[model samples]
Target: MTPPILTVRDLVVTFGTREGVLTAVNGVSFDLYLGEVLGLVGESGSGKSVTGLAILGLIDPPGQIARGSITLDGAELIGKPEEELRALRGKRLAMIFQDPMTTLNPVLRIDTQMIEAIQAHERVSGKAARERARQALARVGIPSPEERLDAYPHQFSGGMRQRVAIAIALLHRPAVLVADEPTTALDVTIQAQILAEVQSLAAETGTAMLWITHDLSVIAGFADRIAVMYAGRIVETGSVVDVLETPIHPYTAGLIGSVPSRNKRGVPLAQIPGMTPSLAKLPPGCPFSPRCPRATVTCRTTMPAETPFAGARMARCHHPLTGEPLAA
Candidate 1:
């Protein structure tokens, strides 16, 4: 097996609020192999985005990475100085955020932003950097790259803006890309195009991607492996086929069953009961016990250790759901 391009182990992120310190990520760990797309799927507030931010060392004031190490190509990123981390961003590791509107500077021309990004890490003439930026824009399927580069961020359509943001991230051909809901705001056609471009880029460049989103359909089609997170912890993880087709954790099954297309026509949607609890007031034992149908007294009384399953799959549950057993 190829050594992992990005490896995060036992990561924990906590935020300090007026109320108290709230844990956003708890003991999260995963490995992204070269050229592989690893999907982190869970509902909002499940810590999926927080995990990505923590990995990138983007957790700002009031939030902190309390534990764990993020290794990029065998280099430990945890506790690294901000100056060193800044150099790594975009050049070695890059991220495409959910909102392109906020990501780009309104006053800066697309060319200026992209050129600055390029020249920041590599010593290059303005002409060479501009050429690289234009090529990147073209690579991301933008038309008239030279003209587009001169346009301000506000002039571009939502989908186009996203493409521009993505193009900027790809300028350096970073070793790993942490894309947090990069297609959430685009139309279906645009979404498909972006996904295809991302897929192709990873294949050609061997850039490991951590594709974070709450959209299971996207994960089904794009992710090589899926990690199901809930209440700040990874509750289940396995190959995409195994996990999506035959989810073992109750929460995982609930998410799959709740998808609109999977339900019987005209029937009410099957939603997992109750809401995700607040991080500051998480329940004892299994964080998901409140909503898990298969949960038992044991589940509510003590946290379940991650149990190994067939095919390197694992689930943190006292009573793992064997889909068939529930049907019977």
Candidate 2:
């Protein structure tokens, strides 16, 4: 079997706050294969975005990747020097933020930024790199790419700018791409287009992508697999069909229930009972126990280890759900 393009094991990210050390991502693990999109789904503060930053070595001061392994193409990245990680970031790995402005410079023209991005990793001529930049823009469905490249980031609308960001992230055809809710802020129509573009591009370029989002519906048609995260940990993971159709974790079921469905018309939209638990003070047992409907005494006192079910399916729940998924 071909090895995964990216592997993350027991990833723990922490920050030192006035209240003390807070673990944003606790013992999260997953794998990303070439051309596969893994949807990391969870609500705000679930640490999905933090996981992406940790993988990219972008966690700033007070924030650190505490004890774990992040490997890209079999090379360990967890303890590598900043210089080494920087060298690999754009060439072997890349990231796209939720906001295009986070990846773009307001003052720079799109062409200049794209050309510079290409040049930063490869020793290509200016004209050659510029042409590549134009091609990338076109690949993302940006019409008049040649002319659009000459404009500044401000000149482009939100959706168009996000396409530019996606174009830049794919410029190197990196082995892995971590997208942290890149489409969350766009309208439904634009979000669908962006999702389609990204899905097709990943297939075309053979780039393994970690797409982070809280929307189950958004991930349903976009990802090959889903990793349901809660309270800084992955509660369940499996193929999109299996996980969505038969989620074993209560948290996963709750998230699915929250999504609007045609079958649920006129029924009150289901909702998870409690708010996300605080990372600074997670429960001693399952981090999600407080919010989990199926949690028991064991679930409230002892953390459940990853329990494997049939064929690559796993969930961190003592009382895993069986049969059909929640009827949302």
lDDT of 1 by residue, 107-205 (tens): 999999999999999999999999999999998889999998899999999888998988888888889999999999888788898899889977878
Candidate 1: where are CA atoms >4 Å away?
323-328
The pairs that clash in candidate 2 are none
Q: Tens digits of per-residue lDDT for model 2 on 1-328? A: 7999899999999899998999989899999988899999999999999999998999998999888998888999988988998989888889999987566899999999999989988899999999999999999999999999899998888999999999999999888999999988899899999998888898888998999998889889889999999888899999999999988998888888988989999999998897897777788999888888788899999998887777578888888887432322
Candidates in order have lDDT scores of 0.90, 0.89
Assess candidate 1 and give its lDDT: 0.90
What is residue 266's positional error in candidate 1, in angstroms? 2.1
Model 2 lDDT-worst window of ten: 319-328
Error of 1 at 284 (Å): 0.6
Looking at model 1, residue 292 earns an lDDT score of 83
